[model samples]
Target: MKKKNDHGVFAAVRMAAASHRLLTVGTVLCVAASVAVSLLPPLLLARVIDRLTAGLPLSFLAVLLYFGSLALEGVLTSAQESLLVLFGQRMTHALRSEMSRKLSRLPAGTLAEQNPGEVAARFSGDVDTVEALFTSGIISMAADACRIVSIMGVIAVKNTGLALILLLVLPLFAVFTRYVQKRMLAAQLDNRRAVAAVSGQVPETLHNIRTIRALGLEDYMERRYDRCIGDSYAAMERTNFYDAVYSPVVLLLNAVVVGIVMLLSASGNAQLLTLFGMSVGTSVAVINYISRIFAPIESLGMEIQTIQSAMAGVRRIDAFLDQPERTIPPARREAARGDVEFAHVTFGYGERHVLKDFSMTVKQGEQVTLVGRTGAGKSTVFKLLLGLYQPEAGTVTIGGVKVGDITDRERRTCIGCVEQHFSRVPGTVLEQITLGDPQITGEMAKDAAALAGIDAAIRALPEGYDTVCTEGIFSQGEWQLLSIARAAAADPAVLLLDEITANLDAETRPACWRLCAVPPRAARCSLSPIASMRILAAERSRSGAGNNI
Candidate 1:
């Protein structure tokens, strides 16, 4: 789908600023006040020097004004920093929360198509870049701009000729700025991609650590990671090269202007020394102001580069937010009767159809086992049943009502699934079992674990249900058991198990079968449990063990 290119970096800034306008406005005011106060010290010092040269007594009040301005500038600077830091934190929190909400609403298919590393990079690195713009870069740039303007006004009033010479250099600086700004964002985006590759590699390597070690592939993995780092380093080097060139050029131009003023003053030329009363005191102040004025231009050049990085991040975030969301129209919330059917279903990934004219029916309360080869669409059947995917040419019905009649929320409440691969969630055993469901109690979790024949494994850990169980802590077979236990904890009317015992060893096979013995709830019939397997026996179906396909 075509997306609107509008609302990139500025929209993100507006979103953050909207939440804390008072704080944002206060920070800008402090920056402005600090810049205004800082110009005083240089002006006051010039006055004192002029009086000294005139053979007059130094005014104590002038010195007092200079010192007092310094103090006031320091206070304003501190307040600006403090306010920006607070705003940065608040903005980081709000943006991250918004990204999470957007991710949650996206379609399952869309999420599956995204790379984990890329998503993580956007979430952390991109979000941080935007935060930097808010917390330090934007405010500091504003202050530098104000300082430059105030110093420029003072310089122009003091001597128009000198101001004119200095002003000529600005157009060159503007051209240089435009050139650098154009290249920066593209380079930063490439750098972000390189960094994301690195981010994805680490977790992927960790997940396959056992395989890597078993095959002695450490050097191979290390070389791959080195490639990612090298690309990122090269991207950053290009950006820094622009920064290297811009700062020195501005400094060199400022120095040249200062040299002309000093030489003209020494030559005692009336045109150079007398205009706007450009005496020794005024010359000194002008030289100082040149540095002050040029300093902002240089810093601003760098800040503009940072702003580009933030803009790239905003574009990424906006693209993600624009992706299609899973939408379930309002539908009946009636409970499913546990009778499931797939009528003439046709589905596939892209053009390669996996299921063609498929039909199936399982009576309410009947435990059915679907047996098929790896490519025979058994898993696809379960996906269709669970509403994870829609068939192109058929209807799936649950409880005698079409799946279209059920809301996503209602479907989730009625069905639970245990798939072949288990996600390694970081949490205690109980937390893993309940999966953050507030309605499930510890006792209920333990009961679910017991039904899945995983309760003994849970109790073996030092903290039992409270024991932390992340990746690498559990064997593949044990992890599958935990997945089943989690599905059981949901206590849904229909339970779908797709090759749940595929990873189990011979020793764990018997224990896995006990998972089907979970006591049916009051509204659940005996036929609600459906298991897909790679092999099945006719005797098993006839013995009421499970209906085999």
Candidate 2:
């Protein structure tokens, strides 16, 4: 199937903003009102100064108006910032939710290939950067841009020559801003990659600690980890360098512009006077406007830095969203039966073909054993039956229904698989058995445990079924039995045991074999070489005991 094109982060931002129209509109209004209110204070202060210089008494109303504008600007600015934070939060929530939904649609192979720690960084760190993009980057930059432009418009009226000078210098400042931001963005990207590596390394090291100790590779592992951290530190240093240089250069230009404006205003030449001419009140107001213009300009540098950093995160998130999704088959509501068939099935992982033109059939009520060495397609058969991957050729079916076409919920009830190891979740023993499935009742779980020969072991716990599961609560063999109980909880039609006894000791093997001998209520077919052998041995022992009796 063809993949859907990604619309990128801005599309998500727009959708989030659209959902909260009131917050979006409120933030914009606050920003505009703040910008408009900000201009009033400088004008009022200029008027008050001119009145004092002209030996005129200042009216109480005029003084009140000047202070009132200042207070109003402060209030509007505060409100705008608050609104921005709220808006950013909404965007973050929507973005994370979207990513989570995307995860379910991704191909199983795609998910298997991803590093858990790096994927987590995309969910947490990268998504947080997106929030910062809205609150402190894009929205903040827009407001600062408007403030600069508005202040320039006032200065243009007060002094045309000064406005012209600013216009010429602003573009150069913008070019420099873009240059520095690009460098910072490159550094940030490098830093994020290094951080992800460091995050992944921790889990990898913990998982392989035994092998590392056996091989005496502790020093080597430490050096490798140190190198990742060092890379991150170096990238940060580059970003800091650009950040430190940006503000000082902007301030220097601001001082130079102010100096030139002051000098020209005081010049004796008629042409310079005509262009830069200003009365005492106008001169004070123009200076204030110039200062205001540069303030936002300086702030723009910081905003741009934030934006550049966030852009790196945005690109990564977009890449994740763009990965091809698995093709979902049309939903089928009919219950799947137990007869299994594999016809002309060709499959491979990358370049190595595990099964080519293979065919098999296990009729209802039949138990079949498939014997194969490692890499001889033993586990591959289970994966194909479970529909984790699509076959290169032909079909695998359960009761004439293609396995790949089965929905996740139906597949669970269709086939019960007991893997070599058990996956523990954060919950009580009963929850572990049910795995949070609303369909499975407590009685169903208890029956599954009994079928797996672990019901007595669980009841012996402190709180029986409700006891919170923890490490050491159950031995390794018991954990495997719980896994079997979990699988059988749904009363599946077929049971696929993939080396369920591979990790069990001799003492646990007999119990597992005894449990397998007890036919499940719904299961009509059983497939596994190890399981078949144990079942036959158990049956032979029962027959021998009967004869002795």
Candidate 3:
């Protein structure tokens, strides 16, 4: 599978944007309307302040107008928030659906690199940042623009010279914002990476905790976790520092701009600058305008940071979705009848050849086993048959059909295999036999369990057929028999058993092999359960008896 490029991230964002189009437009309009309504109160307050020295009738009217504007702003702001929440929900739903569908189509190996825990975090933690783009980003910038425009326009109407003086600081603010933008972008990306690293590490640590304690490496594992968290802290600090430094700086500089505007307005030498002196109302309104401009600049920084992380997360998720999966064609297939053949087949993992011109054939239904010295590709042949790897040269076939022609999904359905390290899953006795195949009913499950010679042990448990055989209680031989039982439940035409007795104690070997002889039919018969077990033990107990004929 290939790692997605920047183009892929853009594509994913575009897809999300498209899916959330109506919501996106609605949120934008709500923010804009909210901003316009919120701007009105401060302008009305300035008017009331400027006109307050007049008598009670005028003052009372001003008070009523100012309070009314406040009420309208409140109503509009609430609507804005409601729309943002609705849109956020819609976007989240679309993003989650795409991610889930991608997981289904992606190959097993690609998903293996990104464990379930990390993938799960994207569904939860990563999508969380998208809210900033719609809510914080839209609302903050819109209100700021509206307030700044309203304040500036009113000031311009009263005195254009004072407005021009305030406008001079805009370029300086832009330069400063651009300076913080680079550090902010890098820090935000780093923070998201750190978050994903922590996400991946936590699950792995728990999964492997047993190994950590077994080798007296608990301290070592703890130190590793500590290091990850420490790195995450540093990344967060770097991210927060940019946000912390920029907002205060923007505020302070805007205050300086206000002071400059104030001095110009108050001094008689600048009488031409404004028709009105620096009245309390004028000072408050000018200060309010400065406050509004600060928001646009400073909020832009926060929005940029949030968007960078969301974009980074989108990149990873897009990479996962876009990556190739095993790369077999849709038309690929092979005949699956257990007539195995290998013809000058050569294969390797990287540069090291594992199979060297391997060639052989077995007739249909023939029980053939490969025995060789260690590292002689004994299991490789079995792996090759099941479509785990493709040949480097020549071909492998079943029923004269080429192995590479078979898709992995199809190949899997046609083969039943028990691996060397077959661990028993945590499940009831019946589940262990059926391997969660609901099609294999209680009767069939018992039949398969009996064939694997696990029925007696299962029946003896605290709950017959329902007993959960898990580690720390059940022995290795019990798990091996359970593993065999799982394979038998499938009713496979050809069963592949590899190293089934690798972990069993010597005393349990004969009984384990004897149990294999009790085929599925034994379970449905009138013979006693132990009777079949006894027959298996007796046959293997005698000399010159082995599993293969």
Candidate 4:
């Protein structure tokens, strides 16, 4: 079943290549030209040797033709390789783009459950293997197969006895080649596993550096790392042993075949002589062909190894592309408004139900605070409101519209959430606030920053809002303040603050209250503890808004 899926992936790759007809046709032409051009050099060399044997002076044209064939073969071979690389790059680009699009369509649950390292490997490592599958695996194997068959056909025409010998010898060589490749592949996989273990240790050591130092476990860690390295070294040594043995065996076989052909050409029997007899030049060409054949045969073995190794990566990509995707609701134009309501809602992560038959409502212009101990489904409410997950029963609605049906663009303007931690993206300080939303203009960002009480600190920087942000540019508390500015920048109709003050000091805690003063006085606000309901009631009274707890 998995093999069938792999074949489907190959078919998809073929379709991707075919989409670029010009490149595909050019690559085919180059491969064909390279194979035809490769045969000429030895044949031309044979002619040159025959003239010398005849005591005939070689013409400049003959020398030019011989060397010229060699040069043409080199040029064609390079072109073929270059075209394959370009074609592979195009395929990789298309594949990655498709995967990226797939990510957007996948259920949020799928992404949340995925391992960051494994997901990264799909985009980076597995995608690279697919490229190798094209440039080094399949296409290279095809070219080598053509070269080998063409050489065999020539040998059959020129020397039947030698061709007969090759027919018997080649199959045995192929079987031996496959056996060696399989052994090498096993060693290579073991090496990769050991290497991955070694790679993982670096980050683990860094993350636990303080613990290691305090416990005096430095020597223990070093020994573990050393073991991983030793395992990798042993695996590589095994692979190297097979690699070192293969080439010499191939060359020895070439020499033996050449020797046998030479002996048979000088045999006493007329039949053997007729089958193997050749002019001095023909013998030279036949020997050169024998030597040439071994190279492609060796390449075929390696290409087989490459293809087999890449199949694992291909299967991973296939599974990713086949994951169940989220269903997109049709676009809605009406702005989200009115009371925020949760009616008989039930939700959970797998079998662990966080909220069951829960219901709540906060009217417009109302300030609501949910105060409870940890594991009380406070955070789950915000996730449901943000449409990260759909309720298993009933509905969560804003202004009579299902929250799950709200488009992402509308959600940004409709409901603002300040999470416990500020997620820093790669950009300037202003981008951190605006999040590159075109709708959040520069003026709006500045206003929200001022509202969150971070505008003064931002202007103090060398580049002000334009300063390229880096670590330590803002303290932990200031990053939280920046997150508030981000959430409020869109001037959302309702703000959901999920323990935003949990990480903030007393000095920074007051900045969160300014969100209540933002324009649109009717906008509702929901806050979850680390602030007690008593404090929220005080703020509500101070701001002259009805409070709900």
Q: Highest TM-score among the candidates is held by which one?
A: 2
Instruction: Report clash pairs, candidate 2.
Output: none
Clash statistics: count for each candidate: 3, 0, 2, 0
Residue runs of model 1 more than 4 Å from their true location after superposition: 1-15, 214-216, 272-277, 328-331, 400-409, 470-475, 510-549
Give the CA lDDT, 0 to 100, for residue 520 in model 2: 33
lDDT of each: 0.75, 0.83, 0.65, 0.81
Prediction 3 global C-alpha lDDT:
0.65
* Model 3 TM-score relative to the real fold: 0.78
User: Which candidate number would show the highest lDDT if scored against the true structure?
Assistant: 2
- Put down candidate 4 lDDT per residue, 98-168, tens digits, no spaces: 78877898888789887555566677777887899889989899999999999999999989999999999
Candidate 2 Cα deviation (angstroms), residue 174: 1.4
Q: Compared with the true structure, what per-residue lDDT tens digits does model 1 show for residues 1-549?
A: 324543334555577788789987887778778888878877887888899999999888988987888888789878988988888887878778877877887766677777899999889999899888876578788888878888888988987877777678788788989899888777898898899999999999998999999999999999999999999999999888877888888889888888876676676666656653476677777877888888888888888888888878877877776777677657664566556788899999889999999888976555566665567787788777777777899899886777656766666556777788887677798998887777778987888787666789888888888988766667888888888778767566567777666677678865445434333231122122322221221233344332222
Error of 2 at 60 (Å): 1.9
**Ranking according to TM-score, highest score first:** 2, 1, 4, 3
Q: Tens digit of lDDT per residue, candidate 3, span 1-549?
A: 434442343444567668778876777777777777766776787777777644324567778888988887788778877887776666666667766766676654456556676687777776777555555654555556566677677767755666776677766776777777777667666766667777877888787888877899888878877876787788778878877888788778877777776776667774554444566776687677667656766766676666666666666666556666565646643445546678999976567888988888765434444545566776777677666666778887765666657655455445556666665666777876766766677897777677776678888888998877666545777776676667656555445666566655677665654554434333222111122333332443353221220
Can you tell me which runs of candidate 2 are displaced by over 4 Å? Answer: 1-8, 513-549
Q: What is candidate 2's CA lDDT for residue 489?
A: 81
| TM-score for each predicted model, relative to the true structure | 0.87, 0.91, 0.78, 0.85
| Tens-digit per-residue lDDT, 193-221, candidate 2 | 99889988999999899999999999999
RMSD of 1: 5.5
